[model samples]
Target: MKVIQSFIVLVFGLTVLVTNAQNKIKIEYKPEHPLKEKIEGQSSLNFDFIIENQSKDSLKLTRLEVSLFDKQNKLIQQKFLDNNGTAPSINTIPNIQWNSVSTNLLFNPFPDVNSMTDKLEYTFTFNDSIEIKKVVIPGDYEQATDFILPLKNKILVYDGHDFYSHHRRFDYEFTPIKQLGFTGNFMRYAYDFVVLNPEGKRYLNNGKNDTDWFGFGTDVLAVADGEITAIEMNQKDDKTFDIPSLKDKPLALYGNYIVIKHGENIYSMYGHLKNQSAAGLKVGDKVKKGQKIALIGASGSSFFPHLHFEVRNSINHQAEGLPSYFKNYNLILGSAKKEGTTHTITTGDIIQSK
Candidate 1:
């Protein structure tokens, strides 16, 4: 079935180019490499479809409609591409200029088909005339298993300063990844933790250096017992209070990161650590939960010292992000401390490890 699906997509790709040569717009679907195994009614699939404007005039993308059809050409479902009612239109607000490209996410929900004959049909309005395109998508959809939190007895602070905290919703969180010319892993559940003193301040005194920040140089412990499958430790920490450019130096986005494979298809990623902190560690090293692996640092697209952590289904960045919770921690809210093991930490919640 997988082979048949690949062949269909390849044939569709070759034919799509010729079909759109006379039209002023073109569409193409980009799926993740090494596609995950598919499971019926449990797996969700995602991909990116790009719309290129070959016309000379600027055009407003008023509406984008997508439909899913079974092998018998029966319509299964349909959706409008407008940010789930948050936005007015799809990608372009006013207009998409000539020769420009707009990438949109194609997210399919559960109860997915099990055969390779399923198809996706797109109907979009550009300016006045409506355009249409069709493509054959892989029907194999595998759902990710739930992940357990690995950290214990650790006090983490969230002040709403972290990028992940600010954009926890799918509508806002997934936009950045699309703008970066990438798909999958919207990072809606990613977290960044900082430390605060008793006075609830993130820094000591002037906070001009890394040592002055409460979280700087603090031990970054492994969240779970797992093998170190990947590591990137060469990136240097950004100067204290110096803003790093994510655009100019995109490769340094997650400076000095490590990936731990905790279980089948479950990996925890620790990003933006101090330079050379994990120098002694290498791929295939087994690390126990709570073991000190690195130190927090202001590195890789960071403005200050914090720990960027997330659990993903796959090692690659394109994999879907899974929600993570701490096994044991005391939630601190304005002088109140509540001990809980299954608590899902949120913005402005200060946590103390038990």
Candidate 2:
């Protein structure tokens, strides 16, 4: 039977007998490349939906009102379906190719196709409550290494950026889930190798709290032996560090922050440290490499509790991320050896010291 006939029953408040009665809605989200960086930069207000009527009913959705909000509790915007189409309202899909260096985009003919097979995508805009995508200053980074920097802590490699998706970074995670790998959404860098959560829980999230994350303070650790370089301590929470919108935990946001220097060209950042950075920290204090510089706390501009660590090259207040590596380490990448030391390390390979 043609799928459109099923919709007649849907209007009468009757559950239409879907064509694939047993086939659940199969919808997948494929975030564009540079997922975190792009979303962080384009954090303007907008409404984006990718709904599929997988039941073979040729769904007709109208009056699509999507409630939108701002950092504040004010209702920011709303969206409604204007017309009826057999397919979801995606505009286009494009051929996306990624590598260590650059990304290339090739626009496909059709706008939308199932993620498993399609290229090209269409975008949608929201009501006037939106503006141009904001551009927060990019975070800092130092050059990564081609060598292996051995670490003592057990590692969990999060293949994607979502909930409970930590994989094994350095051999094992000490739990049954370690062997199971990840089972959550990976919006960006799906194939990229990232250090997993050390604490066995997510320390990072999009709530204004210090602990709403899926990978907090676990992997963003000290890169070298260094001292407390500079500490930006404050307890006056700028915004709710613990909420999603006005309705959720509405009283926590950007709780605390700190920065440390490792060497001439290497530095590290520990942001959203709760009140930790404020507790009698002084400049020029001597700190060992592995010593706990600051406790994990949700402090500033955080949607969750996690540490945001990065390596950079300057102390003039700003440094760009350069390629870098650790000393005396070998990586066992998925049962293979990608060995290096004192050079630069890309985000993969199980690492350890001899």
Candidate 3:
């Protein structure tokens, strides 16, 4: 029997599948990299899927089996999940309400295949039967926009575009914004920058006050020449290292942010800024690359003072994020130092402008 699947690609990077069966189950999927990042050494590949029930009867996912293959059709690995009781399920209520279940996967691709995972097979087992989905991965075609470090001098990539970073796990669909009908991972390729002391500690003294942190109040520079599209410069900074609750202050989550339009639909955002730090700048102001825009602070939803930066296709932070690389920087790892130009920097990297 031939199984036909129809796919509808959503604007926000999700591909929705509408099946032929009466008990419809829509699966939305997308890989972090369409294929692999053209890197010399090993790097992790990530992807996720959301399964939504659309049938009158309840559905319970028992197990999820995954098989990965390389370019030459060689099996790299196979694994089964569902250690947490039932894998996923949907409940029927007063209304035709459905509870969606989502899963995320991360793994290093085989180096022999040039870090390429050519194919993926997903077998989803429900209470009655199973369904399979096969996907042929494609190589990345993203023309990464080159940028300059948003801050100058020895900066630590405190949190970056790493597989386990909270930035990687965030998507508007699962956030408080979802209630407002937004759906995209705006910070998928975002970075959090801080300055660590020679001893690798973030602060001194009792560490209770924000001023104890070395990165607090550091000048935030514009990554490129751009027109200021948005600016929020008056949010008050937190008094301590403790992260404040954003339950009632949702807009404060960004903590005095500035968004710049750098042409070609690419916009850069700098968040978690000190109150009134961007005093003279406002929407419609044009700033040159490396211009000082604001000062880093522990404002909004931050636990410590740091610069939260990201590049995205839309001025709206709810849109999809764009991958980017820095023009020139020196990477420091203890006693070793490496120079790079037009390269992607990830979590834990200590970088300085060259």
Model 1: pairs clashing at backbone N, Cα or C within 3 Å:
38-141, 39-141, 153-353, 153-354, 154-353, 155-353
Taking the tens digit of each residue's C-alpha lDDT, what string does model 2 give over 162-258? 2222211111112332233422111111112223444443335544453454333333334556766657555433334433331221112225544
Cα error, residue 197 of model 2, in Å, equals: 7.1
Q: How well does each candidate superpose onto the true structure, as a TM-score? A: 0.57, 0.35, 0.74
Error of 2 at 335 (Å): 6.9
- Report lDDT (Cα) of residue 185, candidate 2: 18
Report the error of model 3 at residue 67, Å: 5.4
lDDT of 3 by residue, 202-254 (tens): 78897788899888988899988889988887678962222233333333467
State the lDDT of candidate 1 residue by residue for 1-354, as single tens digits: 999999999989866754564376666654443132332223333343445666554545556666777778888777665533555545433233333444333332222333443666666665534456556455443334333333332445453212233423333124555454434443534777887777778888787777888888788888778899888787788732222343333224678888898888778888788999985999999988888898888778677888888777775445566556565567777778777545345566677666
Best by lDDT: 3
lDDT (C-alpha) at residue 19 in model 3:
34
Task: Give the local distance difference test score of model 3.
Answer: 0.66
Error of 3 at 187 (Å): 0.9
User: What's the distance in Å from true for residue 309, model 1?
Assistant: 0.9
Give the winner by TM-score.
3
In model 2, what is the error at residue 58, expressed in angstroms?
Answer: 41
Q: In model 3, where do residues sit more than 4 Å from their true spots?
A: 1-23, 30-47, 56-121, 134-141, 239-252
